[model samples]
Target chain A: MKYILSFVLNGQPVDVLAEPTDTLLDVLREKLRVMSPKRGCDEGDCGACTVLLNGEPVRSCLTLALSVAGQEVMTVEGLSKNGKLHPLQRAFHEHYAAQCGFCTPGMILAAKALLDKNPHPTREEIVEAISGNLCRCGTYQEVLEAVQAVARGEYAEVKE
Target chain B: MGECIYFAPTEIGEAVRLLAEYREKVTVVAGGTDLLPKINYYQLKPEVLLHIGRLGLDYIKEADGKLVIGAATPTSKLASNPLVAERASALAEAARQSGSAAIRTTATIGGNLANASPAADLATPLLILDAELLLTSTRGNRKVAINDFFVGPGKTVLEPDELLIEVSLPHQKGKSVFLKLGRRKAMTLSVVNVAVRLEMEGAQCKDARIALGAMAPVPLRCTRAESLIKGQVLDKSLIDRCAAEAVAESSPIDDQRATSWYRKKAGTVLVARALARAADMEG
Candidate 1:
């Protein structure tokens, strides 16, 4: 039941041996050793396992590993360039958006997916984009401020 | 637990052929929003996982005086498509309120209908739009009215070998609105949802359709309530009566989302509001 699943991972091509039942989240965290995407609910209800599939946010836990063949997958590890933090990451750091740091990865990726498509999202749009992600530490206010700061072009130079 | 075979078909013909070959053993997954939860929880163990996302069924177009939507079309596309918004505003609204942005990106209309949840956000709107589903198989294709599609909660009339290929909506002259009273604004199932469509000729209602969700074993069309307003001028009193009738037609059950009693009260109010909005009435 194991198959060679080939895909573009964070701008690089990868081929992993995975079972048909293996979820993209499992392959990334276990098989491929990319640990940004976490498995919280295992079900799609909780957005802890969210990652960008083809530049759009999706539930990695719900996505079959084999189904992502020949598609682009992006995790938080793929965010930075030249060993520098992406603007969103810098904003989150400066704004103290991470307390427990569990939902931070998924939250940042979700916001990145939103900003990539729409650079100037409104406060409401920012909320809608990350509504699926649940931060148990109750860091939503800080998360909002961080994302809003990025939208305001405060970290425009840091973006790559 | 046996090994599961995964098949991602790039062509519609191949997809249907796989369905025909595997029959009931194949679990068709598009978004995996619904199916994956079962699989992950070990509630469903299928011998085959047939992925039809790349079968080129994602489209929205007008043909033969009807709006044809590919079954595999994502909910996010439906929510944003100009044609769907212009022609099926209620459906667009329903799609927009379906799930969070992440879930909506993957969830398909076909998967939504085929899953047959009583609280399916798309069902009530499609019912009011008088949509028809085209189910295809190796045998052939057959169209089923949206009303006749649902068998019960978590069940549909789709045969084991059949695939829902398309959903078509005929031209309708009406102002329609969909309302959902969920636990929260986003990422929640409907406590009670309603969609109402009113084709008005000046002051009189030319035709009317009312559909309710989560208040019955299936997403239900309120024919009796719709008949009350048809060919009559919609007034506050008549709309109230129609709302009551719609709730009366539903046999709600108590669940985690809501109680049957609460659903009756909320369903009535939601239907009345949807009716008033569709008819361009006030209060």
Candidate 2:
């Protein structure tokens, strides 16, 4: 029972054939070939598959693909516009936040979701926002620094 | 596992009709926080995945002197809702600490209650608050007290054709608090969680309700412990005795998170702490 699942991916609309059991992570990485969101854990424990569903951070691995029909999903691939990185992405690259790069995509998107809602989040809020995403390389410190730098207006050039 | 039909009905009547038609074969998915993981692991392969997310059940309102929460309402919304925080502080705290921010965004109270985990974070607070669950089917509707909802671990009284539509909490006059003991701060299941509500008249306790989670096959109300505090002043010694008495009603078991012996010890302390916090006697 494959259905045509139509949803807004990033800023564009997309329709893909998906099964009832297919997860959002599966459709994004496999069907659409959007490789930003990682597949570290098929379960929801590891937040490697974190993405923005309607501007809120959610575990795509645990999200049913059919459930997200007609909703908006944003990933790390959609952050950059005209080859210019989003503020969070640029800050992560500059602050050495990507150790293994496995959790970077989810981490950055989670931060973006936070900053979008709360443009200025405190250190604790920043930590709590990305608490679900686990960085196996232990780059939490650097990730924290990167998110803090953005919060402190260090990367004020690129608003998007 | 091969072929499946997914139905995302927009209306509640339509959803219940589908559930009645599919019966045991339909798996109702509200948040998909718990069900998808089981589906991914092949632990549950439903022939019909009935998504109730779009059933217009994500809401919170007050009616008939009760706080009515829609079954599909997410935990994050509950945690931040001003009415919930003011009226049911224990439930708000429990919702705030249920899971990580991401999990809370999608996880629903109905799904958590339906899943019927022994350590369900929402269960303790709801139990202490004397909440009632409204279960609906194509035939009719019935309201069950929260205390009578759970049967055992991963089991509830919900029939295959019935759907939990809403949870209604009557206005209670008490200061309540919730405390959870987990392996870690976030994204961890509770080893033991306690919720205490105390209706205090100056120094003497007017009424008390104590609920403990992960200390039994289901979330349990410590009737003996609660009765001990009624019409009595809650002092240090009395609180300790009540805590011990509450733990006596539990039949915890050794699992990956904790041992039965350890749960009794830690649950006693946790209950005492929650009682103190609820009574505003914390030192």
Which candidate has the highest lDDT of all?
Answer: 2
Residue A112, candidate 2: C-alpha displacement in angstroms: 1.2
lDDT string for model 1 (B128-178, tens) is 999999999988999999999999999999999999989999999999899
Q: For model 2, report DockQ.
A: 0.83
Error of 1 at A1 (Å): 1.0
Tell me the number of clashing residue pairs for each predicted model.
Answer: 0, 0
Candidate 2 lDDT over residue span A27-84, tens digit each = 9999999998999878889898999999988999989999999999999888888888
True contacts kept of each: 0.71, 0.75
Q: Distance (Å) between predicted and true CA of B101, model 2?
A: 1.0
- TM-score of every candidate: 0.98, 0.98
* Residue B217 Cα positional deviation in candidate 2, in Å, after optimal superposition: 1.0
* Cα displacement (Å) at residue A51, model 2: 0.3
Show model 2 residue runs off by greater than 4 Å.
Answer: none
